[model samples]
Target: MTGIDFALNHMAAPRLGLADFFALARSLGVSAVEIRNDIAGTAIADGTPPGDVERMADRAGLAIASINALALFDDWTAERAAQAGALIDYAAACGAGGIVLCPRNDAASAAASGDERAAALREALAALKPMLERAGIAGFVEPLGFAGCALRSKRAAVEAIRDVDGAKAFALVHDTFHHHLAGEGELFPEMTGLVHVSGVVDASIGADGLRDAHRVLVDAGDVLDTVGQVRALGAGGYRGPVSFEPFAPEVHRSPDIQAALRDSMAFISGGVARPAA
Candidate 1:
């Protein structure tokens, strides 16, 4: 089988530098790496430009997978537009295939339900499509499963982007853990552009306080079904990275990061997509 492009999220290693990230990825059997600007030890989310992030990726010999799209990119105001434009420019420079657009976090104020927020986000996505197409990039729209996230499923995201001028302008980003949290019991990876694989081994913490910080990788009987979810993505015509995105405190603290990665890869390959018992 062809090796999938497994891009490591920078947040996986907290104290590691750009150089260290590259070395660790190469050593860990990863195919490529994605640099999340917000976690890259600087004020990137405040609108760090593409040139700076691109340079870092180039120096590391890591192909830029996708630039993480965050904040209120869907507000459609002048300020929001400017910020979105800056992020597009940054994605282009990093040689990313696309920029990932996450929908807004729900609020107690005027934001309304996820559906309403998604509507506004759809309009904003339509506006941004032109820019992404102009730059020869696609937009990767990710639906956060947390109660606060407006769009929480690939089905919802696909529907929103369905009527846009550039319908192919973007695709869904699926994370196994998020899918479970949202109770997305099945897999439909045809709409997906990226597959972020991180295991949630901890059975503690109520869902409200849960963050991305506890992600690990696949193993037997994993609650998130990381391996099966990844295999499902492959089955659904997404031949992209099954990237590791551990935001776990332990994964970062472990001294032998390489060994952990190796085991993770082995487990993923040997165990993906077993029929449910």
Candidate 2:
């Protein structure tokens, strides 16, 4: 079955309290949740604890799909590693399956490209392997597929994971948005760890535009051809949770987040039920 994980993007719903979000998730038939660390009221809501974020998830009876990501690993100074380690520890406490590591558009974008930068990312993750192992969480590497974006494909991300010797500690989040932006034709369905789905109104509103903000519902669009994507997942033998990561301002504007998410689930199941095998 295709499960849609609702994202708590602060920009989308500034007023939606975390408890309200839990109710919304239950109403929307979502058993899984992926919280954005950047959002208000979240654990580490502001580089600090938001208090009982994990307890809240427990109360909601939800499984943490994943953390959107911990950005900027290229500047792997000892101090920075300590800071990143804190986030990892929090993710473990929150019962998150993994933490997404986005190498592109990171705070350390200035150092996100070139072999040195890539190697630094590898080094950083390697340095954190012990801590991550102790925490028992996987590091999910997500590639941002855009021209100006530093990291735009799973290939480099895969290499980074390999270099970190993180086969056990790391996995991949294959976002369809990034997949299209990267113009990626290569398939590593077997390599796919987690998959994110969202649609854009205009193709031009792609990598350069509002980005995750433009993530609309999977209504009518080329991206909604998720059946092929799901088939690809099956072919790749990916059994991970597929998240409905819509970052649109309009979605949050909806008086009811539940209905919108249920619609998304229907679209996914409808699309994926088609045979591609």
Candidate 3:
């Protein structure tokens, strides 16, 4: 197997400032990063202008790969449209490569008719395509594997993109944790724009019970098979950044985030040479 390329997601160290976050990414030998607008008191949350973020990343010699996400994207309300426009503007101004679009996840969202959900998805993509193209950014659609998520299948996202003529403006986010939870074996490398990697090591929890809180850095105990998943994506022709997105509070609270990250990188990279049996 070839070497795995890695990128850093700000969720790993939400407490850091913009400059510090970029520096941490550089220190970890990761040249690309994904920042978030959701964390309170942070750069985006604190009203740091888009140009400032671009300048900060430039000074640090880092690439602002993508904005962490635009949530409830599948719902596609007027409010969501407004929010998407604003985020796309910021992404263009900040020189970020793209925007992550997360599907609506709730019991109500899951209960909607399949046809209704498909129609909404098509409408949203058709509406979002021009904005993304004008801004020169790709929309990275992430399908959550949880039962309550409105969009749970990459195949479904691809089909919707085709229906809306969004093949060029949108791509899929093949998230390892979600893939495991979804029990999906397919890897759509051609349509994948990014890959999110995380691990769940709790031996007692079943896939149905898994939640974002269970996500932690990949390690020896990882039950989600992060190594094999990454290898498969790479072998299947994916060459994008494998960004870390550990939602577990413990990872954020780590006293030495850099060290912990280094360890995970080593573990993941080592797996390339010893492909899982």
Candidate 4:
């Protein structure tokens, strides 16, 4: 494994405003960050304007890695196209490297034919690639590992991207939490753009029962083998940021978030092995 490079995600500290979130990333010595559009009264949510977001990040000396996501992106409807266009425009304006695209992860989505799903995904990628290329932004397609998710494997995303000849404009988000839930042995670190790291330490719940709310910082108790996942990604030539994306309310409500984040970073960095000299 190579040395790990860490980044921060807004979900790790959801209560913080845009400026404060950037400050947190800087405080942890992380210069890159992923921002969210779902948070109310925040940059994208309050319509704070993309120019303002860019300026705010510049002032903080942080690179906006991505706009957290464009949800249900695989279906590729006209509405989704408009939504994607708006996010791509914002990403371009805010100097973001990419937009994270999350697929539909619901029972209804699961009911769709595999062929139908693949066709829709390919169509969506074909339509979005030109737009992303024009804006000089990469599309980070994150396959949800959940049973209900439409695209549950990184391999599926990779195949779709290849089908659309979007290697230049598309990449994958290798999420450790999702990977564990997905039960897939495949790892496409070469095709990855970002790595979302979080741990599920609750032994009471089986893997199938795990939810986003169960996610927290990696530690001695983590059941998902987060360190091993990082090691695999690194050994496979992935050199991107391993961003913290804890969704547990305890993490969100941490009275001393800085200390908590630092501890998690230490645990992750210390656990993953370093490559040979």
Candidate 5:
């Protein structure tokens, strides 16, 4: 079997600046990294020039995997179009391959009828398709599995992408945490463009109760079965980046983040290499 191609998301080390973040990724021998707009004082949020980000990644010999996300993407509005355009422009300028599209995850969106949600999803994707194609970038649609998430299944995202004939410019982000929360069975490796891997080790919280604060680096105690998900994706024909995206405050505050990351990497690598039972 092919070895896992590991990538790092800024969320894994959000405290680091762009240059330092790129350096950290390189230090871990990680070639690709995801940059996020949500992080305060970061390039995207601080209005740093895309050229500067590109130069830093180039100096560090790292690839910008994808801009972390365009939130509430299914609720396309005039403002959303502007935001998408700007993000796409920046991603192209930074030489990034794709931009992540996060669907609406709120009570109202969740309350929508299934048919209504599906139609809205298709509408937004159809509108974004040409824009992404024009920029020569892929839209990585991430389905959040929270109870309030409007898009909770990769199967639904795939269907929407197909309905809009967006396969050429769109793909799915198979987030292990979200997958576990959604209780989804299909991997859809063929439609997957990226994979976000994180683990929940807290034994007290039920799957429904798990939150981003509970996310931490994958370890032997991980309840999310991240290693199994990775192995399944690989065996099913995914040869894409598997990115570390722990969101726990503890992980972000680790004094020795590099060491912690290395340990998680080793643990995941070892697990992925083991023969499946």
Candidate 6:
């Protein structure tokens, strides 16, 4: 069997409460999970105490891989700093290893010159470094593949992290969906802290037309080549968490999510073990 370290993102089962969510992960034999701040009426949003989150995770034998994200991270402002600080604090208190940082993905931010955008990213990373260091947590910078995203290139993100000497405080999240959407060829496996996997089997949708609503569990029909991506990352030295992050409403509403996830995990594992043609 291939040594694939599977993890679960809360998005995989958004409707489940923290307790059931943690239980679900454990039931899948997945010991790692990523929680999100954006999910309404959830742990972070519902004001679940960090200690409670920690205790619940402990009870379930799960590691909190990350708190999903700090949005618009590259467009750092005083308010952004505050948000980052709060997230970092919460992540640390909840015994999470890191917090994800998402760059602004809007027209105005994306319209900036490449140089300008890179500079802004560096500046933000520089500002976030010390706070992450103090909190003893890494910041996983997730570059969206959407055209309008300010930071669309992983290479550019790695460069910025190096420019700010923030390597110790930051790592990349190589999302299969975003990597495919971005049409990026390079894979920075050694620098990746997490991997978000999803599938889009809608054969008719073009890259630009794809949205979160279209993402579903990975299967043989996956158009994103998620299995190939996972194989490449594993071959490239990234023995990190490959977390399920399907955002389709149908998946969230699955009556038997456990079975669906189990099948997806088996497919990925079997695919990865097969010899390349």
- Any residue pairs clashing in model 6, and if so which? none
lDDT string for model 6 (128-174, tens) is 99999999999999999998999988999999898899889999999
Worst 10 residues of 3 by lDDT: 268-277
Q: Write the per-residue lDDT of candidate 3 for residues 1-277, one digit (tens) a residue.
A: 4766689999999999878899999999988999999989888878999999999999988888899889998788899999999999999999999999999888788889999888888888999999999999999999999988888889999999998889999999999999999888888999999999999999899999999999999999999998898888888888889999999999999999999999999999998668569
Candidate 5 residue runs with Cα over 4 Å from true position: none
lDDT of each: 0.72, 0.68, 0.92, 0.91, 0.94, 0.93
User: Could you tell me how far off, in angstroms, the CA of residue 5 lies in candidate 6 after the best superposition?
Assistant: 0.9
Compute the lDDT of residue 262 as modeled in candidate 4.
93
Tell me which of candidates 3 and 5 scores higher on TM-score: 5
Residues 82-189, model 1: lDDT tens digits = 877877877777688777787666573134765667678778888988988888888888777787676777777777788675567887789887887777765657
Is candidate 2 or 4 superior in lDDT? Answer: 4
Candidate 5, residues 4-56, lDDT tens digits: the string is: 88999999999999889998999999889999999999888999999999999
Winning candidate number (lDDT): 5
Ranking by TM-score: 5, 6, 3, 4, 1, 2
Q: Which run of 10 residues does model 2 get worst, by summed lDDT?
A: 3-12
Write down the TM-score of every candidate. Answer: 0.87, 0.85, 0.98, 0.97, 0.99, 0.98
Query: In each prediction, how many residue pairs overlap at the backbone (N, C-alpha, C within less than 3 A)?
Result: 5, 1, 0, 1, 0, 0
Taking the tens digit of each residue's C-alpha lDDT, what string does model 2 give over 149-241? 556777877787787677888777777777877777665766776778777767555445536677776765655355566657766677776
The alpha-carbon lDDT assigned to residue 168 of candidate 6 equals: 94
Kindly list the per-residue Cα lDDT of model 4 for residues 1-277, writing each as its tens digit.
5467789989998899999999999999987999988888877888989999899999988999999899999888899999999999999999999999999987778899999889889989999999999999999999988888999999999998998899999999999999999998999989999999999888999878999999998888999988989988898999998899999999899999999889988888877764422
For candidate 4, the C-alpha RMSD (Å) to the true structure equals 1.7
List runs of model 6 lying over 4 Å from the truth.
none
lDDT of 3: 0.92
Let me know the TM-score candidate 5 reaches against the reference structure.
0.99
